[model samples]
Target: MTSPQLENHLPFLRKTGGAWELIVDNKPYLILGAELHNSSMSSARHMESVWGKLRAMNINTVLGNVTWEDIERDEGVFDFTELDRVLVAARSSGLRMILLWFGSFKNGSSSYVPGWVKTNTRRFPRAQIRDEHGSLTLSDSISIFHSECVMADIKAFTELQRHLANFDRQRTVLMVQVQNEVGLLGDSRDRSLQAKKQFNSAVPNDLVRFLSSQFNNLQEDAKEKLGRFQDTLSLCHPSDQRSWEDWFGSSVYTDELFMAYHYATYVESIAAAGKRAYDIPLFTNAWLPKPAVGGGLGNLIAAGGALPGSYPSGGPISNVIDIWHWLAPSLDFVAPDIYDADYTATCDTYKRGGRPLFIPEQRRDAHGARRLWEAIGSHLALGACPFGVDSLEPESFAYTAQYKLLGSLETLILRSRQDSKRTFGFYFDEFEGQQADKGPPIGVSFKEFDLLISRAFVFGRPSPGCGMIIEIHVGRYLIIGDGFKVEFKSRSATSTFTGILRAEEKSVQNTVTGALRTERVLNGDETRSGKWVNMPSENPDYGDGFIPLLTPAGTRIVEAQVYSIDE
Candidate 1:
């Protein structure tokens, strides 16, 4: 299928059926991505050491940062020397790039802004927060209320985009992140004199109209939060101006909504300007809020806090995501930096409004690495990225093997986007002692049959596994990955029994050509005597006995067809 024509052949996001695909060079592209450390791309020398390792890890895309302070050390003067060098290296290494623009804000602080913006607070203006002593103090983050800060950011970002458009015509840069986890750090809402005055004034007519019109389409959590103000919202007119407290009620959440609107608009100005210079997919990442855990505030604080300021107030958390969506139309989507949050739940939440799901930052451990299956297979994510990969050795990288497998199945995965219901992806993680019961078998219903998928059977203790099942045809499946088994059941009412008819261990003949060759035709032990099809783990334990019912993993691909006996 051909992608829609876009301006300048720039990479864009398109929807196919109920799923989203990232189109590059007139074709659907799957990103096997890894994000570098924040400072890794600041110097070409530092990135030179990292590019070779990323290629070895099977990473197709590199998410790196372009700091305002580094690129524009002096006001109105820009330097793209380091950024250009890094781009050249990445292209030579056969890697795509997603540049994160660290302007005005980085993790709720203005530390990454150029010295001119940082030192001249009177000109750019810093946000103010109430201290513990109830005194208003300056925060490190710039005030979004001031146009000076956003205008400076827009100038720097537009220049960056213009440079990329001219210097790199190959389109090596696939996308750009507008900022890094933006929001206020010390307080729920900015308490500057101007901010106070604006808060007391009537709310924006545009925002009031959005809430009144799109109320039904808002996320469930957002709806719940706004439920109390339903009466006021219903009775309000589009031109009616009311104080923040009077419109949204008296609560800290109202403060969050107020800040979310400003932050979204602040980002919109930069993103919209950058798009005008050179249109490419642009998005921002959010530092998600952590629900209270272990019954203590310490865990909350460590997990980025339960309240707004505790965790970058006014950022695009789920509760305030609708506000960002309404206000930040220039941003392609709002992505989540998932750590210490429910990965699957976060994916579902961000999938609101039919927006694409692309994890910009996540954990680098095995536990975090395994969840990408659900993100891609079930949720139809454009990509999943693990942060801080430059520091890890290629062999030690948890996603190395996963990326290799995914790279091989990239064609099939992308094709499944058109009919995602015929595909499913799942994973089972290693459990603590006696906790294996929690990892129950997954059941999914297809057009013709039902599938019960579980950890690949072993005579000894079972090992953790992850894989995806795609229905190549009715009653037939192509299974990929290690440590999984499938039991098929017929949906027909008259069917008495269902069993595997044929199971073949297969290897990829050519990934580009999408050709497969069967290595072995298995019957008795491998298929559990026709009861199921087993794709054994990398090293299946045999309980130290003579019987060899289980075998070690091979190519980790299997094709199985199931049949039913109708009574």
Candidate 2:
């Protein structure tokens, strides 16, 4: 299939080499972004209070909401006044936007839908869930099986895109999220009459064909989750009439698969319609499932439960992501709203099939801020945005320092995208007590040698650190950020010893050109007596009143050259 012709002048996603990059003004742009609280963008005046603060935090992009209820309050009526004002305000502040469309569903509920749609249950039916007592009750979410509801969403979303195409002439809005965390909340699959009728019918031939043809290429998590059901794909014919249960086993996972197929198709309709109106990048975000912490409903809601209904039944969690990828052709990608889940694992899963990793939501804390390095440097992510950033002060925001450093190195980072295989990112979180579990030392192999990267060496307790290493040359590396040290070793069998020949602390002399100037010649105590290249913490502990063996972080960047001696 041919790709859609996106407007060249506007911001869009493009695949370069083995990774994806966001192109803005015809250049690779990285999104140093943060998401405002849900209601923060509803009012222009309210957003005014936070735009300057977001800028202060070095956030170039803001993920704000444009709800259905706000845009299409009355039936067939559309209002872009407030949205336009907010867009103008953001542009004035020199910030881009990613508008999240809270249509039909927000956090697995139809609370954001227009009141008319909510009241007219007969026309736009609510999804029904089967309670534990076997009684069917209405869920707060709309049923995806209903065509009227889907049509309404498509119409509203299409109008929104059309308005953006005309109003956002400067391309201030980079992308649009179709819906917020959509899917059934209380049930695995909708139990409404229409939903049940469709559920009991034959599985869609197209979906069957996709699974059959793409089974080998499916993410490992998806393949393993399929279990014995995977065998059915090889045996069953696409034209064969098989019920959902017949094709997949009768379990909660089967219910989830069923919901996923419908949800993806539902989103496909909306996303396709929007793209037809205005061809720009579009995506949806998933409320990721969290580990069960042995608590009840309250805990389950706070920390997403493992089961399907426990977390928005089928909102493109890793296992069902392939269905979304195959079925939702119009969406640029599916993003994960990560909170407590394994951040690296989630990045690896979503980045399958060469999709760009752009985190729409995550924890807004020091711990969460540190993971952005891994997402951008290691995974070659387009960007990552921490959630509810407006709630925190810019002075105290955890992402401020990280974003500042990343923004300074944005030019160099984008230039290295083609050689991402030679780059690595890592982080160490501050431990509560003396016994530090900073994870095992990460080992990275290059063409000439190897590197053992560990927490920055300090005389006292280690502080949190995050950094990335880029192999600018065969034996030379550009180390950025703080609180990390690198130990080089020879990969050749004949070489007996490998050590840092020279290490220089460098500062960004020109942000636009990415020009650097040597700030200090790091050696002796700074490089651990030439044994390793030390990028010490901002405040390195000296332990006792003696000769200071470690220097505090300066420039938070180092250029090191390693040499090996042959036996």
lDDT of each: 0.86, 0.86
Candidate 1, run of 10 with poorest lDDT: 293-302
| Model 2 alpha-carbon drift over 4 Å, by segment | 1-8, 230-236, 294-302, 419-421, 434-436
- How far out, in Å, is residue 514 in model 1? 1.4
lDDT for model 1: 0.86
10 residues in a row with least lDDT, candidate 2: 293-302
| Model 1, TM vs. native | 0.96
Predictions: Cα RMSD each: 2.1, 2.1
Cα lDDT tens digits, model 1, 437-474, are: 54689999887899999988987778888888888889
TM-score for each of the candidates = 0.96, 0.96
